[model samples]
Target: MNFLVFVKQVPDTETKIQIAGDGKSIVEDGVNFIVSPYDEIAIEEALLQKEALGGEITVATMGPNRGEAALRTALAMGCDKAVHLEDDAFEGADSYATAKALAAVVKKLNPDLIFLGKQGVGTDNTQVGQMVAEMAGLGHIGMCVKLEIDGDKIRGEREIEGGRETIEVSLPAVVVAQKGLNEPRYPALRGIMQAKRKPIEKLTVADLGLSADEVGAAGSKTEFARLEMPPAREAGKKLEVEPEVAAKEIVAFLKNEAKAL
Candidate 1:
């Protein structure tokens, strides 16, 4: 079996973020980058799948040159190969365009199964995985937490809004994984050494035979005009009273002021 895992680079949530002057984009300075944590879990699941089913784990990602860091991290975690789809024209893609680019990369790889994170923190849209599946004309299962292979089919456990659901799907499918699928493996010395020797295929927009109108801001049907922070929370005043009265006051405050009740 050939398995392809889609990975993405995102701002480390630990870092502070600033919106750019344009308002639609983030300010890059001082923002640390790392693989999307959800994708990291997907990569771990792919590795585990490969270990049991016996296949090469391949990773694909799109971004600026710095995006290679995510691929390298995947390699260190035991992925056999990687492909980096990079271009300046790829900046600010909407979900459709992002899916188009990713589907194109997956076609070039021609894997039997595709693994993707349930969501990328960068956008948090939860749209790309399903969009990619639609673009590729493949079966898609979203929010999968547990996956088991049976012959050419896969059975999975997924989280729905209020509960979990089990599903069975045929092969050559796309799966978006949630956390708890598998614990990601730390990069081991041997894996890191192996990763250093593994080959990574690098492609640009020209390599994929796509034009700017097909993948970048031009291709995106949606546009981000501006983004602003929400209004700040006002400070609360402390209330002083006897214990019983204070308790009643607090309950009243919760019901009226906080509206949490």
Candidate 2:
């Protein structure tokens, strides 16, 4: 069995963010970057499946040069190789365009299973996995918390509003993994050294036989209209009044103004 894991790079979750001066983009200057945590789970799941079943796991992503870091992180986690889809054409791509680009490569690879994080931090749109599945016409499962490979078939678990449910899916499926699926592993020193020798194939837009009209900002359906900073929240006040007196006053305020009991 062969597994293809899609990884992505985004601003580190800890970084304080600011909207760009244009109000249509993030101010990425001096911002730290990291692998999307959700994708980390996907990578871990792929690694575990490979370890248990014995197969090659390939990691893929499309991004700027800095994205190599994310791929290296995956390398440390245990993917056998990496494919980077890089081109000036891919910049500012929306989820739809991004998925289209990813689908093209995934089709070219034609792996037995495709795994992706349920969402990416930068967009948090939770749409790319579905979009990729749609574009590829693969059996799609999103928000999955568990996965099992039985010969060529796949059995899995997904979360519902109330609880979890088991499901049976076929191979050549697209699975968007959720956080609870697995704990991502840290790179061992030996793995880091080994990762340097792992092959990372780079593809340009032309390599996929995709037209300029088929990808990037121009190909995207949605436009990022604008962004704004939220107003700061004010601090609450406290009184030194007696508890009984305060309780009575709080009750009166709740009933008359705050509208709570």
Candidate 3:
């Protein structure tokens, strides 16, 4: 079995973010970047699947030159190989164009199974895996907390509104991993040292047979007009009153002030 996992590098959630001077993107300087937390779960799930089923796992990602660091982290985590999709043309790519580029690679690799985070921490678009699946003409299951493989069938238990639903699909399917899928493992010293020697295959838009117009900003369906910090949150209100009165006040606050009713 050949398994492919898509991972992304994102600014650590704990890091403070500043809007770039261009006012359309975040400042990258001083921001610590790491493999997205959810994608780490996906990588760990793929590692587990490989351990049980006996296969090679390959991790792939798209970004600038720094993206290779993300792939190296995945490689250190036990993936057999890595592919770095890098090119200036790939910058500013929206989810659709990003999926298109990744789908092209997916077609080339034709792995038996594909795993990805349900969403990237930076964008939280939650669209790339599904789009890649659709573009590659493969079945997709999102928000999967459980996965089981029996011969040719792959069964996935995914989160629904309030419960979970199980769906079975054939091989060559995409699985968007959610939280609780599995705890990600840290890279051991040996793995980290070995990862330093692993060769990552670098690809570009031209390498994927995609024209510049089909990717990056030119291909994006949406564009950011501006980026700004959100307004500061107001301090919470405390009411010292009877329980009944407090409940009524909370209701009124929700309806009139919070407008969440």
Candidate 4:
């Protein structure tokens, strides 16, 4: 019952993002970073599984050195260990490259079950989990709202467009957790203190036997040509008249300005 959970560090949802001068990335300065909210749900699900099945939890993340903060938070939340994949060669990695790196690490760990969020809040790609599963040659189920493990098989209920679907897969599978799986728990003070003493293993692309050309921006199949802020919203108009007159005016405005009629 070895559980491996993948987490990501993303800017706080409330933070205002500013594009970097290179027009390919965001400015990191003064940006508050936290574990991706959906990943927190995955972590909570992993913790629940560990509690029920008596297994160890290992949380991993791929990012710059600053990502260690997110890993420590996962540790504080109850993961037994952490792994940080950090290297300049991994910079500007898209979903495919990220999945390649993570799959390599997963191969080294060989956990019985892998957990991930449905998508990353930062990129919102919703592609990495399936890519990792494919690269690792493991069965995968995505958007799982409920998960259960029995014997050597795992059953999950996943959300669909208008309904939910139940999927059953064998062991050594990957599960992408969706919202409503479970509420994530806050790290306790004692747990936070203990996390400070936990060992965090750091690895680089070379250590994973991957080449620079196979990851980072070089490996990205898509490129961002430019970045810009969305246009500002226009001011609204107000109407002041008798109720009946206002009703008529609204209909006329809709017909002429809004064109809804």
| Candidate that beats the other on lDDT, 2 or 4, i.e. the better one | 4
- Residue range 31-118, candidate 2, lDDT tens digits: 9888899999999988898888888999999999988988998998789999999998998899999999999988899998899999
Candidate 4, 1-261: lDDT as tens digits: 899999999999998989999986889899999999999999999999999999999999999999999999999999999999999999888899999999998899999999999998978999999999999999988999999999999999999999999999998999999999999999999999999999899999998999998988888887778878879999877878799999998899999999999
Candidate 2 TM-score, true structure as reference: 0.93
Better structure of 1 and 4 per TM-score: 1
Give each model's whole-structure lDDT: 0.89, 0.90, 0.93, 0.93
Query: What TM-score do all the candidates reach, one by one?
Result: 0.93, 0.93, 0.93, 0.92
In TM-score terms, candidate 4 sits at: 0.92
- Tens-place lDDT digits, model 3, residues 1-261: 999999989999898989999999999998999999999999999999999999999899999998888998999999999999899999999999899999998998989999999999988899999999999999988999999999988999999999999989998899999998899999999999999998899998999999999998888999999988999998897779999999999999999999999
Give the residue spans of candidate 2 off by over 4 A: 239-254
Residue range with the least summed lDDT across 10 consecutive positions in model 4: 221-230
- Can you tell me which runs of candidate 4 are displaced by over 4 Å? 239-261
After the best TM-score superposition of candidate 4, give how far the Cα of residue 223 lies from its true spot, in angstroms.
Answer: 1.8
Name the weakest run of 10 consecutive residues (lDDT summed) in model 1: 15-24
